[model samples]
Target: MLQIEDVLRDRGSRYAVSGGAVQGRAGADAFVAELKRVKKFAKATHNTWACVFSDLGPVKADDGEAGAGAVILKMLEREGLYDHIVVVTRWYGGVHLGGDRFAHVVTAVRAYFAALHSAQSR
Candidate 1:
């Protein structure tokens, strides 16, 4: 099965940016900027990204790393942060973090959004 280790290798962070339309050319630009910022912060060499932007809603995922990117994107969607954005960045650590460990990292990043959602809901 596909795993995180196959995608991410080390330190990473996920951030969401809201307050703007997440579709069309403008949305794509914003999303790219967010992706760059997150990648810069993580000092990641590679980045996979995906987005769903439309009148229907905003959704996206990176297909570069296949399953790994898809999984991360799904987690972001579950956070329910609409009219917003999410980017997952990773910095290679040289040592393999394994599939389980990698998934944990993705989960941890998603948890940040969960916390944000919880705080906003209150």
Candidate 2:
């Protein structure tokens, strides 16, 4: 786990992105287990998540965020990250963010990737 947490502020919306690396490939059940392991995100309005494993390929859930899973999946594909799951928690600030929401998701995943790289370096 990389212990990544970042808050993205855009268009009056606050997105808290966090994630962990599972060390090995994880399937859908493992992804759900990971979500349950993160107690902090359980009560969030939306726990949008995505995970990719070398063998399992990729799987994601928008958690009602709509198209968020695809955004995360694209990032993972670009980075070539495997056996990792990222969760973005959103707190709506009473404003609509539109496409900016995807940007926030990217911001969150970027933070996670940075942390993951740092951890691997160490």
Q: What TM-score, to 2 decimals, does candidate 2 have? A: 0.80
State every prediction's TM-score relative to the real structure: 0.54, 0.80
Among all candidates shown, the one with the greatest TM-score:
2
User: What is every candidate's alpha-carbon RMSD to the true fold?
Assistant: 7.3, 2.6
Instruction: Report the Cα lDDT for candidate 1.
Output: 0.47
In candidate 2, where is summed lDDT lowest over 10 consecutive residues? 23-32
Candidates' lDDT values, in order?
A: 0.47, 0.75
lDDT of 2 by residue, 103-122 (tens): 88888888878777887899
Model 1 per-residue lDDT at 13 = 33
